[model samples]
Target chain A: MKKLQLIASMMLGLAAAGSVSADAGKDTYTKVCAVCHAGGIAAAPRYGNAADWGPRIAKGVPTLYQSALKGTPKGMPAKGGNLTLPDASVKAAVDYMVAAAGGAKAAAEPKADAKKEAKAEPKKEAKPEPKKEAAKEAAKEEAPKAAAAPAPAAVAAAPLVQEGASAADVNSFNRLLKPAGKRNLPPPEDGIHDPANDGTHALQPPLAAFGSLPKSFAGNRVNWVEAIGSGKIKPRWDRTDLTAEPIVMDMNVVREVKGSMPDVVYPHKQHTQWLDCSNCHPAIFTPQKGANQISMASILLGEKCGVCHGKVAFPVSECRLCHSKKKDLVKPATAAAR
Target chain B: MRKLLTGLRGGLFVGLVLALAAVLFVDIQDAQAEYGDVVINNHSDAATMRPVIFPHWFHRVRFACKVCHADLGFKFKAGGNDINMVKIIDGQFCGACHNGEVAWSVENCNLCHSAKPGTPTQVHESTIQKLAQPSGASQKK
Candidate 1:
């Protein structure tokens, strides 16, 4: 009876130890590594693919750990771009992946105590199967639902799972519409700059300079137009020639829409303030009225006016902002008939 | 006979108004992308990765079109340029700036491959269906 009790206690201790490391590895992988590894992105070894793991495993476990720790030139960011993760946790995640790919023997050297634990709980290896299936299902179902919903404008708005790894949707692509907390981080802290570089740490934070700028509701919450007009910011018009002046065309092109929405009055004055005429002419737009087939669909797809509006400028969400010109309701019937 | 024509006109007006409302609602729902962002799927789908969403405006504001279009050898058409990892790490195309010197290196995969899963390589699907519909409001012109 005493021997049985001692053996039972030992089994429980081993199981707990094994589960702790396994859970930690899974958590880290799900939050960080899964973004690329799960999909084999950029040729990242897919999770649970023994065939993919065979060649990599032959290279030895230390090499795998080194690759994960330092990152590869083929596009694996060091520590999977989550620099906060401890080295031990990353190594454990690697072990977890290696064990799953039928390379359990290779991963046994580093964690000898967990060897028996891992073999005892072989069922734990199969658990990721269900999760992978669910992720694939979710990916599959999301496509059709996104298509059925109108407007592809929000298509690119899909959350980048890497940045925060939280519930809050981080729009990493658009610098203008970052979440409130993420806005105006210091140069080094901001993902744009290399944190290791001393120059980045010395640079002025954007929030400090942006304080005096005129405020707007959208896109970094600064009214750039108002700032430029008020002479608060004078952007150099040319790169090489200091005296080069922008040919600011004040022309407004009004596009007539058939629906109840107001006609789109595209102001060249605002556009020409920043861009050269050659930027749009001949390439994006033909520079003739009725010659260009400017549709809302094409524009939403990142064409014509969309080349600027939904990207660097204000997003398309502000409807009244663009569809400003009121239709002449009194003179409509004659034009419609013709 | 006169009343029937008047009634027909009234019915048509109501239908047009409803159609217009539907179209506007769709536009509002769909228009969610930051302007000047291009989604590049060219090979990502086959590679089992999310499509790359290139923020054109972010670069455009800092540099002129000629810098990339002429100097860097990037083609004018979307998805026209054959951008691969080999060329990038070898110091060509995006790698010229993204090589841990000018900007962030190509280490961060999700930074570029952050598009919604299954997004086609095209900038946006041309609304060929909407354009084909003869009864749509645009046809009135």
Candidate 2:
């Protein structure tokens, strides 16, 4: 199967190499980036949002060029996941996105040549310095003006940024001072049904491995819920939609085990966020409970949920990811002791 | 004040039980070092119905890791390679040895593309001979 794709890619590469044109970039952006950037999908910087694009655009077209040409650590795939595109076309699309989000100045910017882009590493680190220093100076100057401005850094950040820097660039620079602005918003909603914002009655210890997986392993469950709950990271999918437009399906399955293990509770709503209903329905798991024979052995062998868990998605090694609740087991030892 | 005290007592009890549960379960968590075999599915559904299962154990017998990885630039991570059929046919990546001269031509589709399909119901079988006897490829200097 890989061989066939290899051949097909070869053909596509040949075709793409021949038809490489400047206009292809706009077409590429429409096809690839529009989904994410247009609606702020997956926290992608919305186009024309100077605040979001400010810091990124400040990195110069070359650095942004490389991220789009290669890939971001946050799972934005190279060439927007269309691997067959020529490198020129990928860079072209990057410029197109930068311009759309960053405004006219980014569009007029010259193309980033490879050697110059590669050598531009020093500039990337230094780009944010002026903004940071300016912000500090603003704070020092403003100490006498008023008791305290809510976000003096953000307020004074306009003069720090170059005139042409887009809103995104300013937003990126101001994002640094955002921690100081945390208190500005109204207190988070509090209720037993809703997760608590403050650590008032926090139960779990500091989740060390909440941000990223330490190492890849089978059965390693990357608990999205725990990760989101701990406030270390947010789910890429639209989590807020769950509140207003809820889609709930409570699937409880009790498997016959030799000893004691909690029954599997498959919540349909969580999976629906990232995947379509058809991805798993009649094809992967039968609709009828007690119909399919699911076991740990089959999962390890790459059947059922194993299809996504360890491969493209997180691993299943973390047992608690599934058996979220504790169960009362009938123990013969306790009865015998009595 | 009494209500507040009751709530505090409940919270403490829950926290203690959860902490104890964490300690008991920490030992049982999977700390095994070795990784399972990788199932390459990039192009499985592209041509034939099945994906290729490349067993590292099978290749570890034949060649030094450096030969295919360092020299040839085969990425150690799975799904890292840009391996398309044209490059392979031109003697790159798997094609380095998979050419008929070195091993077998890729003409026989069933030769290596033999793993279970992503579809749930598809039954699969592996013909890649697992040598019960010691492998001869390991002796290659």
Candidate 3:
């Protein structure tokens, strides 16, 4: 009886913890949605602003779900950019946002409407209401379903599997680079981001054409060059008149970690080359100096520089790239000799 | 009692050695790669024989990395950019901005043609003064 009670209590605890974490949309909103919605970047509707979300909510929950899932014409990317989120979690976030702005009535009914529409839309796996009946396997189904959702506003999310894709291939790159037959990359279209015409580069990954690529950037660069040379992948940078003037932040501040190592020169100009100011500012790193308690340990665990460096950009193994010496550090005699 | 004391002393000695080794290891394995001088000698020393010694700290204090790296397409690796006299003469690579408009022209080759001898090279006093002076945000065409 004691064992039974203990097990029952543990189950209750797990359920309560999951509900508390998942139900509070505020956490999701801050992490994923705030990147775009906090400042209404790229015309994303601001959070809790009724004027912004009400019209979007009025479109009904299914339409909102479809728009949120498939992506909207008005610059809202499918799944709000962090494609790691499960459909249920995303739905919960949307519901939270609606409740905050459009009131409780707006939150409750659209879910019913979404269920009504999902039942009518397709006869694939027939698991329409991921919220109610299928809550048992929800955790298991989270990853693959997210991956199967694929291509921001580009492709219709067909039911790739009864459950989600493998938990291993959670990131988009894995799915994109999944070994298939030779994939043909489409020509770079120019209509979505042409402020005049709304041309953008948000295209479906050439999944059919893509075979497994070398994981490393150096490896990929070699493959890319080989593909271009052999007429496999089309040239992107060459033969284009589009020249972007690189923005210089001129915020070159050297942070000295008082340790055995030399001071770290945080090159504002270097990082801002590929990323926007907001990408790192107040998110990965606070704009204020010494605010971020960065260490080699956290970086290795994929928090700071590890987020991109090891994954996509150059790895941290090339340490000399950032921990540069100051101009005054080297003696004139040493400088002249070198 | 003698055996126990000997064992304790030996253990203490081993612990001290380990601690010393750890300190030295920390010093040797400095995660931050001390930024220093870069010697660019692609064709400068090989074919034409005039190595281009790049002043890194000078350029960094003034402009961002992307200006030369991304916009100008200058590679980080020394001699990796495949820069040649022809590329610069045609107002392409180095000539794009250094066409006597944004900076000195390619005609003045000796300015960069000088080789390094391992002594730390200093930036021009005028360059430092210009950097110290606040400049407008207008981008060069």
Candidate 4:
């Protein structure tokens, strides 16, 4: 069966090289569909796996095309997550996969005939493009109903996409700070937790629990540092050891800048509170003073202090936050005078 | 007339300085991910999903770096490992912990694939290039 599938794919590839439509199907499959379909991730039907594709094929070819184009709630992203792909390309890829699975000889036969016709008469090749464009239009009309049908009940109830807002409208960066209304949803309603999991539904909603914790302006709106300091939340220091405690160090490393900007004061107390010594040791920073050549550019690019500041910790927008210490002007001038 | 030309030039210099300052201020505002955030786009963009934003800080706080880099065979370099959904669901890379037993399973797609669409796979604000070269070599450049 595996050998047969390999021979089928090779034949498909050769046929794809002969014609534009077949070529697109194979190309789209290789580029987009293969990522999950090739491996059957999250129950996605594996290419050429008869058992996996059997039940799905029973649902019919049009249904399979819909699943491939619109995506399934099971995990498949619509158009294999590339919205830029034309509907015809997506349908061709779906046909390619269906053919490879050996479920639809009827669907595969026309493609083979098309390949032969393309070879015999190159002019006829232009004919398919119009048909494909027409298919694209038909798919566009069917898209809304197919998209609306399979939306999981939980997704519809919670509605991660705000009302009247398209998917593109949502900002993807710096997810730490959510809008006030979106902040602290229940575990299942929150996009992070799996609604299908019963355990997720049982967990406490963040809004209800975070009410007593220390408040901050950014990220989930809870000041983790202050919360830890005030003993509001005690995050485990180790994954396995229940009794393990963090070895907190209350030290500060002050790095002087060359320009007029104030010197940066790195507080070990805050960092050590959450991380172990090895996390940022020789790999990220050398222990000795003035040993590490720190710069604003490196940090901005996501190095050194940047590894965390703009990501999970407070962002670099608070310049005065890190660059807290004022430089001693008289001492430098006096040393220069000498 | 000669004095007027010098005054005009002086005014232009001040305007340029102010403009430069404004640009620098805007640049700072656009700083990338919070520290230790790795954006894995190895396939997501082409697959039509947002790039995966792996929160290094969130993971490190729970388990040491050795747990992943040392035990799990993850290289220190960003995008160094060929992580795919198949390998992850099959219990490799992120799957080792992200499996329902250790953490949340792979069902929550948007949670990790949370980056803005078109975000490339990379270590957010990667200093790896700078660290790879000697301090003197970078300074000379």
**Across residues A100-213, which tens digit of lDDT does each residue of candidate 1 receive?**
898865543222332233322212212121212222322221222222222222212222211112222334333233334333444444332334444435444554556788
Model 4 segments beyond 4 Å from truth? Answer: A1-211, A329-338, B1-39, B44-81, B85-92, B104-141
Residue-level lDDT of model 4, residues A1-33, one tens digit each, is 533443455455534432545567799999988
- Candidates 1 and 4, the one with greater DockQ: 4
**Model 3 ranges off by over 4 Å:** A1-24, A109-338, B1-141
Top lDDT prediction, candidate number? 4
List the pairs of residues colliding in candidate 1: A151-B30, A153-B32, A153-B33, A154-B32, A310-B34, A310-B35, A311-B35
For each candidate, report its DockQ versus the true two-chain complex. 0.03, 0.02, 0.01, 0.04
Candidate 1 chain A weakest ten by summed lDDT: A155-164
The local distance difference test score of model 1 is 0.55
**Model number 3 iRMSD:** 26.2
> Can you write out model 4's per-residue Cα lDDT over B1-141, one digit (the tens) per residue?
345435533543343344334433332333333334566767877898776767564564356454565457776556779999999999999898788887889997777766655545544333442233211121111
TM-score winner between candidates 2 and 3: 2
Top candidate when judged by TM-score against the true structure: 4
C-alpha lDDT score of every prediction, in listed order:
0.55, 0.43, 0.44, 0.57
For residues B6-88, write the lDDT of model 3, one tens digit per residue: 55335433432443343333322211111122345555544554445454433433344445655576643445677788888
Task: Put the candidates in TM-score order, highest first.
Answer: 4, 1, 2, 3
What is candidate 3's local distance difference test score? Answer: 0.44
- Worst-scoring 10-residue span by lDDT in model 2 chain A: A185-194
Model 2 Cα shift for residue A75 (angstroms):
5.8
Off by over 4 Å in 2: A1-21, A73-77, A101-316, A321-325, A329-338, B1-141
Model 2: per-residue Cα lDDT over B1-141, one tens digit each: 345435533543343244334332321221111122344556655665455445332343233333565446665345558677799899898887788865667885544554434411111111010111111111111
